[model samples]
Target chain A: MPESTFLDSTELVLNMGPQHPSTHGVLRVILKLDGEKVLGTDCVIGYLHRGVEKIAENRTYAQFNPYVDRMDYVAAISNGLGYCLAIEKLLNVEAPPRAQAVRVILTELNRIASHLVWLGTHALDIGAITPVFYCFREREEALKIFENYCGARLTTHAFRIGGLQYETYDGFEKEVLAFCDMFLPKVDEYEELLTNNRIWAGRLKHVGVLNAEECKEYGVTGPVLRAAGVKWDLRKAQPYSGYQQYDFEIPTCENGDTYDRYTVRIEEMRQSARIMRQAVEKLAAGPIMAKVPKVIKPPVGEVYVSIEAPKGELGYYVVSDGTTQPYRVRVRPPSFVNLQALGRMVAGGLVADVVAIIGTLDIVLGEVDR
Target chain B: MADEQKPAGSPSPAPSGAGGVNPKAGPAAGAPKTAPPKPAAAAPPKPPAIMAATPWDSELARDLRDRFPDQIGETSTYLGQDFLIAKPDAIISILEYLKLEADFDYLVDITAVDWPKKPERFELVYILYSFAHNRRVRVKTSIADGYRPASAVGVHLTANWLEREVYDMFGIEFAGHPDLRRILLPEEWQGFPLRKEYSIVQQDERWVRENLGIESGQ
Candidate 1:
């Protein structure tokens, strides 16, 4: 004990839920707060960790496809496509042209759907509720198209080892065309609701500013990097699965803020739609599967293949020792890498702005935890 | 012996002893006198070695090898691409050189592969990219049981999670990683599941029996 008098001090710590609605999915963030100003924040994840990579090692190449879909359930098709492309490269097998075109179509549609969820939830997180309904209205249509192709809506798992497991549905073109016609106007409606609104602009502009240099140094890609004025799109820079044959633009923003990220994703929705339309137009008559042997025992080597996933560069690093099962399968999940910048972005901002920034990043906790 | 008797640049050999002349000669060459044979119509040059372009193709790897000649080991060209298998101790040094002198700027990924049969149990693969040069380089170093490669966390912040992941799966320690805790797996997890010697059946049975209520030995 001190000889003289001593004053007592204490700090308050709050456990934001592993169950809270806004935590997204079983994510417990330990926030050291001083009246809505975060002194420090530590994210405690793994409640949802299922040891996906370990599971992948035990499973064969084909059996692992459905499991990856569960990693980023919001954009399952992209996850499936990334894994398929990596396995294909390892096998040294090329997907037929028609299959590549269909893969592109479905992945872009999934991108639109994934962005819709982001837009809807981000808008909802910031007190605007109507756009969620609007987003769902369009998302339902996209899910219908997915269901038509793979008999499943959310986790289509449409892709396979060498190519697609099956061809596109008979009327897939008409459904996608109809969706595109309606999706563009719906994107305009979302822009009308939030893009120029003073309240929305005030909340997001210049908030959580991550510059272009920082974005690249941190390996932040997809809309987040494009939002920071770096025009490094995997689809354009390193195209996969016939993405090069399609026509689209990679949108970028000069200001690297939450607003910039929002604008970039919105524009990306339109671009994804454009790519989908082009894919549908280019759909030709051909075989879907390459002449792959039944037992897919790729040579003993490792290959890393990445695709322009909805969130960012979703890469799959597969090592095969001429075995049915991979020696090691590492998924370079974009959400997990992108979420690393969370602490930096939300460091000194207000707690409300922290939620906005998180929403702006549009992370799906499934992928993060996996 | 008949094949060996043909001249160096002759299009077709004459049937022996036909005045040592090629039978298929064109009109311009038919009346040719012995004017030193006009240098035999200068033969086309042979193709260059495919491996020659490998070093030039990846400026980042080439520059690093040049800058740190002693530290960087022999560069191997595989499929017309260069890969440097450096000594384990020189990994961090090369990474620092790559970031500071070469401006690699991005550490794309840090992964490890288990080659159990080899003397080196693990191959730690670090793929670095230079946006300025628009080229990528795969830097690898062998990790044995008692030895661990130096971590590149100081050079690239992106390696923090990746190194942890490699440690998590492969159990190849990154010597100076700040937080080398298990990333994708829980702390109490028993073994490095990715190792070939690790028994997957035991883990599978344990998981299935404990988590999913499925009985073992099924």
Candidate 2:
């Protein structure tokens, strides 16, 4: 017997954005919703894809350094570090001690800057505007330090194949020290504003809870996985670029909720500061460049190198065929993988909580779409 | 020193005393020598073999070899790393066995390489990581022109998008990929741009025409 179907009970399909403001960046999230609760969410990326890997196959090894910065513009230096480390591993070259120390300082500063942008915009998305301004004030100082070193701020192509393109400029250390002196106090100010504020707590606490098992199943890392109580930071588990020498803590939270994610990142900014301070103190004198062959031709082989990028484990897999150009280059972008867990996290939550969950994930769409 | 003698941009040949025939330089010329006579006195207790049988356990390699002898072309255990090379058709079966029997749950990455000089135009590489065992294995399969390899998307859901990306760039088809649409490029784009022969000039024209259709000529 055929039963009569009712069309009135059907779920509404909403297009959240190939253009909407809060989808992060040209990301189109196809949402199937029933009333105010989300039934399902399908994330459609690639809108901002520039074919970076394809472009890398044609460009010389030296020429690809700058392009890596565009993959995650918010954390430009970290992306550059990942690509450079992969290339360096293939070539079997090690950067000088001073260069490694400087790289640690710069990348940690970049991590702080990236987290500030995420906190500010993420808070703004949830209707907290004052924190955005405060976040930018601190971020400006970090950008100035970057500009002093590389003559560029936002998309700094500071790294090179073998080592740094140039040594730290005169007065660079003084400027970075000044920023750090002021920056730690600014982190406390941010904590006072949002960390314990009742409204902020109400909005975030227990809103998007994803436990450690679920995090691993979905492959979410960085703050998301740490908040879920997994102590699997690539920096600690598998150190690359001399991360083993640094003394910093990997902060974790047991709740695995939106508030936990926020707290973890806040604590991470402090640890990044601690790491930067150690890097500056231990800074040494040596040649920045490694003694690499001029026309670099690594024997045919493939190497996968990953770093603890601000978002998560940003890995680069490079295939060399004894030539200047790489045979293949694949980037295991953290945002793209981390964003896969969004649907599971947001399925049963209210529409308002979706913004909070997205904030907690802290995804940069350029990294995702790349 | 070898570093001083080598000129810029030239590939340095391996030293003659090094083991194996240097790939760049042909085998060294020398007459064969007879084995030396054994000493009359009892030889000092043979030093324990300096080299372990292979860094990786040979029994595991033998087990894998026995399981897929027909499909596996080679099993290499060097420096505590294992590499298994197989035909394109048998990748899914081998991967499934690894995932089910062994606990290699994570598909770390999937990539492809182009070798213009080889009989096979492309080599599809899959790296799997096992968190349980704290070990990693690399599987490679060579594909000739216009042929497709069986997809591993059935084993790990994450491989669906990754395989699509590999197909999009390398123009190598995955026979059983659920959704094989163009990911980075527009659906109507003419050719796979990452292949060695794909022209950058063609991309320039396409970029201009797509962005500014009528004004491209001007």
Point out where model 2 deviates above 4 Å: A1-8, B1-63, B76-82, B100-102, B116-119, B132-134, B145-148, B203-218
Per-residue lDDT of model 2, residues B48-72, tens digit only: 3221213345665677788999998
Task: DockQ for candidate 2, please give it.
Answer: 0.09
Model 1 residue A353 CA deviation in Å? 1.9
Worst 10-residue stretch by lDDT in candidate 1 chain A?
A: A1-10
DockQ for model 1?
Answer: 0.09
What C-alpha root-mean-square deviation, in Å, does candidate 1 show against the real structure?
15.4
Q: What's the CA error at residue A12 for candidate 1, in Å?
A: 3.1
Ten-residue stretch with the least lDDT total in model 1 chain B: B25-34
| DockQ per candidate, 2 decimals | 0.09, 0.09
Which candidate wins on TM-score? Answer: 1
Which candidate number would show the highest DockQ if scored against the true structure? 1
Could you give candidate 1's per-residue lDDT for residues A1-370 as a string of tens digits?
1122244434468787779766677777777766656667777666777768878877656667788999999999999989988877765678899989999889989999999999998888888989999999999999999988878898777877777666677899999999999999989999999989998999999888898788767777789988988888888787789887877889999899999999999999999899889988999999887755544556666677778888888888787766556778878888888877777787667788877888888888889878
